[model samples]
Target: MSKKRKRVSRRRLAGQRVLAHVGVHNIETGEYKPVTAARRYIAESGIVPPALVNVRRNEHTTDRFFWGEKGLFSAQYAEENHFLFPSLREIVDRIGEENLFAGLEALASDDWEEMEEYEYAFV
Candidate 1:
């Protein structure tokens, strides 16, 4: 007789503000793809692939992150495309932890004033 395995629910990723919206970077080909639509597609399919690497941003702490099957819980996929977590982490680090969200959000939303308010030299 086979023992029954217990199933646990891990869907607690809603409502958390994702400060950095990173894309899927193909390390080998130097290609990058946005992860929004692909994430939607994966959600609808119900099958998670291993070869994806997206950065996992901490809601409260932007300096901390991890790597996993999906980009939400951890970093983006890596099995298929060469992993780019370290490099990505470096980029984030250069941007500074305190200003990570403010900087990225400003650029993503085209809110230059926000950056200016932060006293970012870029603005």
Candidate 2:
């Protein structure tokens, strides 16, 4: 008799690393393929991608998102691009506990003045 195996769903597994590799033998030949790799990680421990709880400008990228005043849960590009657990503990492990908390606080205040002060120096 054949044995029956249990089946699993994609939701039960974490998102696979979205990666790609490309190379060209010669640029003159018009082969300009570009290589790519998972620039960030993903987490699908839930039935759906984590809801976007907050958003803020990267200071570097200037990407706009829901600010402190606009309290609403929406999927921001950044969150979607770097999806992770919907809990603080999980997020802290990736971004570091200190930075994670600071980010939350900063977004809560909708104040980027402090971030802006250092922006010029980075340039």
Each prediction's whole-model lDDT (CA): 0.32, 0.24
TM-score of 2: 0.18
How close to the true structure is residue 52 of candidate 2, measured as C-alpha lDDT?
24
lDDT of 2 by residue, 1-123 (tens): 999965432211111111001111111112321111010111212212222221122333222221111222222322322222233224435555354334343223323334334322210
TM-score of every candidate: 0.20, 0.18
- Candidate with the greatest TM-score versus the true structure: 1
lDDT of 2 at 91: 42
State the displacement of the C-alpha of residue 93, model 1, in Å, after optimal TM-score superposition: 1.9
> What lDDT does candidate 2 reach at residue 2?
95
lDDT of 2 at 93: 52
Off by over 4 Å in 2: 1-47, 53-86, 103-123
Expressed as tens digits, the lDDT of each residue in 1-123 for candidate 1 is 999965321111100112233433222211223344334444555533332333233333221222333354333122112123343334446665455434333222333333235332220
Candidate 2 residue pairs that clash: none
- Which pairs clash in model 1? 51-80, 52-76, 52-77, 53-76, 53-77, 54-75, 54-76, 54-77
